[model samples]
Target: MSGDDKYILVAQIGGAFGVKGEVKITAYTADAQALKAYSPLLDAKGQPALTIISARPDKHGLVAKVKELATKEEADAARGRKLYIHRDQLPEPDEDEFYLTDLVGLEGRDADDKVIGKVKSVQNFGADDMLEITPAEGGPTWYLPFTKAATPEIKPAEGWLRIIRPVETSERDAD
Candidate 1:
């Protein structure tokens, strides 16, 4: 399949482990360890492909050795390089479940049919998912919660999302 046909993304890569060219990986898959099974990871440009020789748990990620990398220096050079697999390699998720990548480029709108912005990206900083929307006319980007109440409709086919505006509260009534 062509590179564009692939939907997988490189999650994370670790620094060189030992002189034998072993590195670490942190996959975003539900079963992180299963990433090694996907083997033959592609680079961002889809030029170089890497094969996982062995992968085992080490601290927060899985330590792995890739074919063709026979020295610590080579492994160190690959540090921070993301490994990508074909999107088809991943199992299908149930309906109502969406990947963050699928949300990108989706249109954002309010209840009154007014255009709000376009989804640039989705960010998660521990608590909840945040939708980063960039306005059409160069306005400041807005971060809105991607909750059921805030985002009632998400039509991926239409590439649009309907969001409810947040209600602001005044502090004066607290006194």
Candidate 2:
């Protein structure tokens, strides 16, 4: 296992929120406030990065005070840092539910049970999460909606997922 895999990403530090060094952050956990429970999150290199002293929900995300980031300059400098918690600190997903991080590397199979792609990573753009699958055919990676309708079966322990590939048709196709 890699050092990077030893931790699960939980949040990302945004730019400084105020002149006081309080910064805005996007929390990936089910409860943003729950981030405090896993204080002193780590950076990519597995070094202590953020020790959140206090946090409150804001219109954008959470405004937080970090133990080490005491000044706005320090906070701004840390912007875009991804925060992680030791893997053991996170709870295993309850049956049928899985963490996005856990989904990485799962094989992507089609309805026919044929290899199609590999689960690359999870991405969220303010809406529901999406899976980036690296196509088995070796072209550009594609995005699949991480919904039961699209990815009906996800067997992380089994190391694979069943995807209902979407087929798009247009009026030209009807001609």
Candidate 3:
């Protein structure tokens, strides 16, 4: 994978917190405070962007002071900018645990080995996670519920996953 693709988005700048350069941050890490530990955050292009000078838990998320950002306007301008870190910098996940980014591009298959599509993205719209799949046959993309019953297998090394779709029930069928 390319270096840019090897980075994981860990947080986003919410907005300026105070008159100083401190900005509000919404961290995506397991521990919100751990954002300080992952210093020298990079942008999407993999260039060193923001350095966390100090960070503290806030009512909204976490307030952070960035190096060189000395005014509220400077920090406010950075709002919505995402912070990423190289995947190699992160500790590996334990067995049965996998990063969501790792799931992208894996082939979607069926129990009988039928090619469904490739995983486009994993998203959560205020509900359970959903796997967006691009049809291998060149059709519109669809989402499959990211549940054990829906996706029976996830073999990333093998470059594929087995999906067992839930049965559809109509009123007539139910009768």
Candidate 4:
């Protein structure tokens, strides 16, 4: 299949865990445990698929065993390799929610409907999500919070998001 028809990356093998061929899987899913149900994962080349034999929480990731991998050395060898699932395997998001991948390339406009830039990427730093927008004029990127106040409108079908700039107020003198 072409790259466009391939899978979306969701996880990666961290390293070997125990002597039982269990490998550490760092899941990129919002709910790490839910990743098991989204298997079997495809490799980067779109071949050598792997299924989750078992999965459980370990530190910040999930400890899992891939089907047919029966040795610690074999599991370790797959460390650092990314895991992908076919796009069709993923469920559709609920209303008002969107996947990070779906937001990339969408245009960004100000409250007045003037185009500011295009979304280069969506980032999360544990607190809140951020939108990395590349200006149309080719200046430095802008990192804006993906909050309702900052982003009031997100019309995915239109391939754009409307952002509202925060108002600055001057401090008044004491009465």
Candidate 5:
């Protein structure tokens, strides 16, 4: 697959651990320990990038030894690098279930079934997933909370995203 092929965010490198090459990692996988199973994790460019030789659970995350890293300084230098897996590496989603990566490129439609935009990407800035939409009429993109109410229906198989307009809130509304 090309570098632009879909890649799923699985984990992120944290600070170095101990004096060895081991580094702490924050895994986004459902089973944290399962991170090692996805060997040779890919980087943003879709290249085989990392291998976890071993890992142990820590209070904050996982302390992992990387195959390519042999010193604390090496691990520290790799901190903040995101780890991913090719989309094809994942098992098929169960019925009515979908990976966030599947949301990209789907049509974003309003409640009235009008094409408002296209899904550019799915993002999470620590709170929750947000859908980045490229407007159909060609303006700067905007983000919509990927909540059940805001995106009530998302049929990835059918290339559709049903959007419900969010209620406008003001400072007064928070009073």
Candidate 6:
């Protein structure tokens, strides 16, 4: 991995919230409220771009006031800007629990040790987490549930994981 890719994206400025320079931040961290705790969030260039002065939960997301921005115009200018931090800044995950950043790009192998694909994205569309995998040969992506039954092992250090194929339960398959 390149030095620039070592940083993990922690949050993103969704948009300006109010007349004040507070922006709505969609946090990607484990704890959304902890976004403030990781102050001096960096930009993709690794520069300390934003410092959270205060953050509070709003209806949509966490409303945050940066150290210098003091007006809606200032915050609006930063909309869609992603906030990042060096990987070292984050605490290591517990056993069996890996950070989403660590899981992305990992080679996914089936129970027989056959490489199925590489992890493209990890998404949570309300129900639960899903892993979008792009096949090694280049085809349309398929999704696998981020559950124990589907993903029994994750070895980020080895850059791979074991996937248990889900059983087919459709009516056609039941015939």
Best by lDDT: 5
Per-residue lDDT of 39-131 in model 4, one digit per residue for the tens?
Answer: 777788887566888998977679988894778998888888888877777789898777777888899998778898999988888888998
> Once model 5 is optimally superposed onto the true structure by TM-score, how far is the C-alpha of residue 88 displaced, in angstroms?
1.2
TM-score, cand. 4 vs. native: 0.78
lDDT (0 to 1) per candidate: 0.78, 0.86, 0.85, 0.82, 0.87, 0.84
> What TM-score would candidate 1 get against the native?
0.79
C-alpha lDDT (0 to 100) for residue 84 of candidate 5: 89
**Cand. 2 TM to true fold:** 0.84
TM-score of each: 0.79, 0.84, 0.89, 0.78, 0.90, 0.78
Segments of candidate 1 deviating more than 4 angstroms: 1-6, 125-127, 167-175
Question: Which residue pairs overlap in candidate 5's backbone?
Answer: none
Write candidate 3's Cα lDDT for 74-111 as tens digits: 98898899888888878888887788888999999988
Q: Please write out the lDDT profile of model 5 over residues 1-175, one tens digit for every residue.
A: 4546778889988878999778998888887887788888888888777898988997656898888888999998999999988778888999999988899999999978999999999898989999999999999998999999899998999999898767667855986
- Maximum-TM-score candidate: 5
Q: Model 2 over residues 1-175: C-alpha lDDT tens digits?
A: 2644567888898878879989888887778887888988888888888888999986545899888888889888888988888888988778987778888999999988999999998898879999999999999998999989998888999999998877666755876
Error in Å for residue 170 of model 3: 7.7
Q: Where is model 3 more than 4 Å wrong at Cα?
A: 1-5, 167-175
**Preferred candidate (TM-score higher): 1 or 3:** 3
Give RMSD (Å) of candidate 3 vs. truth: 2.5
Full candidate order by lDDT, most accurate first: 5, 2, 3, 6, 4, 1
